[model samples]
Structures are given as structure tokens and as C-alpha cells.
Target: MKQMYIPVNTSLSFLLISLFATIMPAQAQSAASAKASAATSTSTSTPTSTAKPSLTVTATQVGSGQMATKLVANGSVAAWQEATIGSQSSGLRITELMVNVGDVVKRGQVLASFDSEAVRADLAQAKAALAEAEATALDSIANADRARGLQASGAISKQQIGQYLTAEQTAKARVAAAKASLDVQQLRLKYTQVVAPDAGVISARMATVGAVLGNGAELFRMIRQGRLEWRAEVTSADLSKLTAGMTATVMAPNGEQTQGKVRMVAPTVDVTNRAGLVYVDLILPKDKTAAAFKPGMFARGEFLLGSSQAITIPQQAVVVRDGFSYVFKLNPDQRVTQVKIQTGRRMQVNGSEQIEVLSGINAGTQIAASGVGFLNDGDLVKLVAPSAAVGAAPAAPAAKK
Candidate 1:
């Protein structure tokens, strides 16, 4: 059935209010852990305005080098020995036009001057038929010396002294055909003057003061001496690393550079751009007053294709990420390790931009330059200026010899 019982001072006042609600939540969690350990020892003895973030970066020290390797292409600059200058005599006209297209001629100078008034009236009708064939060859040697002195005094009659010595050999063959027609009318009047057969600079000047040209036509092209050349076109499998003399540079189109040599390599190979032609030469720099080195411009060459022994760096000290290639380095306490590299031949000498390091990285290390995309691995940098962090033009160090 059922049973009920109570008492003992109301179960000792509900067991002292459940042990004073579990000892007042463990004495209010031990007085809130002694006021959070006295506010962490009063913030470890105060004093702090906040600092710690530093990191400028830019190191260097790459080591083990030599790098020079080149190949590049694309080119132009021409006229290393042009020299057309024509007019072997034909019509005429162009009367006067002494030289222009940047002048500088020499060899036989006298650039143009035709219209010899009909070759000076055919050189005055060939000096009036060479003075009427020297007065009929001096009256046929004075009638063959008076018909051999009147045919030995027989009063000239050995068939009239062989007809006066065959009429003095037909008047000395018509005075040697009128002195060869007055030396061909004085050589068509000096081919109507239009000289400059070399020593050049005038790259072109199609006769104009009247222009009547014809035979051999042309008129003036020059450059035979104002030298300059640079063809380049390569690729026929690098045209066997070019020959003739090796050494090149080019680049001009305003960015100026020059310095060339390899004077010829072509030997066919353009079957629709399979590429070939080399021809370098360009040298110019004898300070032609800072001569704006010209000639069909377009340059870009390189060639050099030599040199070796390398390790190189800088090129924003690597760092590519997903596609690989990286290079923080910089330890000695400044932190930042990263590394990973492998690159190979990516030149730009005298102006910097190097990069070779073929394989994980070793030589002198020390990396990081130009804000390596905000660095990471172990961080903690601050190298400061070190010459504005290595880049005011830092590419020369990699080889320097």
C-alpha cells in the first residue's frame, strides 16, 4: 500500500539548502580566480604603446656567378655598303642638285648636274668634228709629201704616184674617223656629271632638279662608308650560333645601344620565314655628335651566345608560388627562409634583371629584394635601405666580370 514519513527539522532544512547551493558556486568561482590573478599582475607592470611590426626587406649576396648567355633577335639598321649612284648616260636633264640626303660624300663627289645643253651641243659638234679632222689630217700629209716629190721628179705619174698614195690613205682614214668622233663627244659630256661612287652618307636621292635619267638610271644611294648594318633575322635553328665574327648588341629605336660585328651568316633559309640572314656590323659611336644612330631602325639583337659558370639572382628574387619558383632566404637572424627556385638564363646585363640559379639554390644565398610580394615564410625582416633594397638598378652583380 503506501507509507509516508517526515521530520528531522524538515530534513535538516532541505539539507542546508542543498549544501548552500553547492557552496555558492564554489565561492563564486574562487572569487573569480582571484580577480583574474590581479589583472594579470597589473598587465605585467604596465608601459606599452604598441609596436612590434617591422619588415622593410631587400638583401642581395648571391655568389658563384658568370652568366652572359644571349641569343635574342629581331633587327634592321642597314646600308653597310650601299652606294648605288647611277646614270651611265642615257637621256639627261637633271641639271644641278649637288647632294643632300644627309650629305657626307667624297669618292668622286659631285652628286648631280645634268642638262649639258644637249651635251653642250654634242660638245660643240665634237669640237667641230675635231677641227675638221685636223684640217683633213694636215691636207693629207701635204698631198703625201707632194706625191713623193712628184714621183721621183717624173712629174707624178706612177698611176699618178698611186693616186697620190691612195689619196694619202683616204685622208688618214678620215682623220682617224674624226678623232674617234671627238672621243665620243667628250664621253657624252662627262656622263652629264653625277658622281659620288662611294665614301658615303647620302642614303638616297633620286635625281630631281629636272630628273631625266635613263640608262643605268638610279642616281644616288651612298652609305658605302657611313657604315651601318644589322639584319639579324635568325632562327634557322639559331643559324648555327652565327659566325663571321660573333658579337652583337643593337637595340636602338630610341633606347639606343649599338655595338655589333657578326658581318654575315645568311646562306639562304627563308623558305617563307624559316629564318636565316645575320649580317651585323653597326659599330658607330665615334661620337658623331651623339649621332642619332639611324637606318630603318627596328633593332633588338643580342647574339653573344657564350659565357657560363653561374648561380645568379635578383629578378625580384624569384617568388612565383603555385607555378613554383620562390626565394625569401635572408636568415642570419632576420628570418624568412622560403627558397625552392630552379630558373635558368633570363638575362639583361648592363641594365640588370638577371636570373639563372638552375636548381634549388645555394651560392651565398641571402635573397629577397624589391618587396617579394609581401614575403612570408618565418618572416621578421627589416633590412632597411641597403641602397633602397637592392633595386635602383641591381642586375650587374650576378656576373660583374
Candidate 2:
């Protein structure tokens, strides 16, 4: 630093200038140091955070209730008892077809007829032969009596009388044989017409007028006693729960419901499918106003397997994937956790279109109803209870007997 002298009058101004220069540089250096410290603090103390997907959710409560396992297996309706009307003898031409398909017939009612002209002729011949044999037997008896009288009078030898007696006995035996032949011929003539064995509707007609039939040729298909059956095949797992006399309802292909009781359970299971056939004898409505129920129609059914207490959730709460069902449950930490569930029967709730769960959910579990349709296994969702959906169909109340 150089020692410089200045005039006394300008000393204050020069001193002021010097002080400004010193203060300005010190202030600039202090500001730069403050900025460097701030930068270092920001780089070292920053926090890490994850962004979560936002979603709306609803909650529900699960409780104990009846669990019904409904099985929807396809099957057909068949006549509980049926007969294939057929003839017994061969070489007969049908002369009349009295009844037709859908006709209700009674037992022993004539269904069809065959030409009996030949049988009638044979029967007449047998009657004539029987009459001739009877006449011959009468003549032989007279000869035998004469032979006995001659033996008593000693006019003919004993050997000659014995020969006449033998001849009479042989003619008597021939008469008996002829009578039996005539009886058989009459019986055959009666077989020319076919009759119903029981009361039922005719399902089919195979024979017609001028058609020749062989032995045991089927003519008509009759449902014996107007009875029908619903044959439903169920899986092996469910077969054990079914029993005789259990109530069952069948929905036919034409949307007709038939009420019946379980009749028989097949002992042998189908090897391929491991299922058994369940026969349900239908109780047809006797009111003529009811529609006519026929056999061989495919049907669906529900069998009441008895009721038990179980946990159930709403069907809307369940999420199905790859043939399995799952539901999202809220943990204690307000996070979602996936849980696998086993569902039982599906039932209508209070006449509303919403479905009620049969089983697998617990009581008081928070469930996401609407928004979980797009969520993944471990997604974080913001819970928001949704208002009941609009225009929802009312559920059906419990069925009353």
C-alpha cells in the first residue's frame, strides 16, 4: 500500500469512497458462500417417495347364512314307464291304424288291426275237422257197445270184440286232438289286432295300413300310465349329496318347469366322465289348462341338498380369473390384499338383479365393489364407499312354500 497525502478539505469524501469499496466486496463474498451451503444441503437431505395409483372402492360385511350348491346340468325328459307296441306272430298285414300320435289311450284299447281273413279261414277248417271227429267218435262208441253185446251173447269170438273196442278207443283219442287244434286256431285269430297295455299318450306310429309285419315288429310307442321322468347326470363330487325323495325342479328346453322327487341313483358311474344318472319322477299337473309335457326334452334342474350356516359375500365383490374366484380385502394398514375364495350357490337377493354370494367371504371385510374391475394383485387404492347403483333390479325375497 502507498502512503498518499490528500488535501484536508477532500479527506471525508475519499474516506467514504474507500469504505464503500471494502464493504461491497465483503458483502458479495458472504452472499456467494451462503448459496454454496444451500446447494449442498439440498443434495444430501432429499426424501424418496413412491407414486400410488388412485382408485375408488366400496365396503361390505359378510355373515353366516344358508349355502345352497346349485348344479346346472343338461339332461332330457323321458317317459317313466313306456312300451314299444309290437306284434307276436309273423306274416300279417295291417288292416287298420285306429290311434295316432298324441292320442290318449286306455289299457286294452285297440291301437291297430291286421288282416284276419287267412286266420279266419284256418279257424273255420279247424272247426269243421273237430265236428267230423266228434261224429266219428259217436259212431265208434256205438260200434264198441255192439261189440260188447255180441261178446255177452257169445255170437262173436272174444278176439273180434276186443278188436272193435280198440278201434273205438282210437277214434275217441282223435276227437280230443281235433278239439284242441280248434281251440288253438281260435286263439291265433284273436292276435290279429294290437291293443294298448296301459293308459298313455301315443308318441310314435310305425305301422300303417297294408304294411306287412314280422314277428315282434314295433307298431306304436306308448308312454305307460302317462308318466314322465327327468334324467339328470351330475358330477361324482355332487352325487354323494343327492338322495332319494329329495325335491327337484327341472327347467325344460322350452322353459317349462317340472316338479319331481329323486327316484333312483345309478350305482354305476360313467367311466369316461365319472358321473351318475339321477332319475326324477315328475308329478304332472292334472289341470288340462297346463301345457302338455313330453319326454326326451332337454332340461336343467336344481336339487335341494338341505341348508347349512356359512359365510357369504355379494357376487359383485368377487373377481373371477382363470376359473378361480378372488376378492380384495383391506388389511389393518389400509392396504389391499388378495384372497382366494370358494363360492357355493348363487341366489337372487330381495327381487333385485344383484346376486348374493353363497360362501367364502367373512364378516366385516372391506370389499371393493365397483373399482376393482381393473385393479391388479397388489395395487394401492384409495377407498371410497360408492352409493348404491341406480336402476338396480330389486331382489327376490325368500321363496315361500
Prediction 1 TM-score vs. true: 0.42
TM-score for each model: 0.42, 0.62
Q: How many steric clashes does model 1 contain?
A: 0
Candidate 1 lDDT over residue span 1-401, tens digit each: 12334576679999999999999999999999999999999998786433232367667877666788888899687677776878888877786887788889788878787777777787788778778877877887788888888776797578867876787788778778877887887888887887787676897787788767688978778778888788979878879867888888877766768688896798888899799889988787777522756777677878887888998887866779899888888887776888887888877777978888888878886777756676768766667666765444322212213
- Assess each prediction's global lDDT (C-alpha) against the native: 0.77, 0.77
Best TM-score among the predictions, by candidate number:
2
**Cα RMSD, each candidate:** 15.9, 10.2
Which candidate leads in lDDT? 1
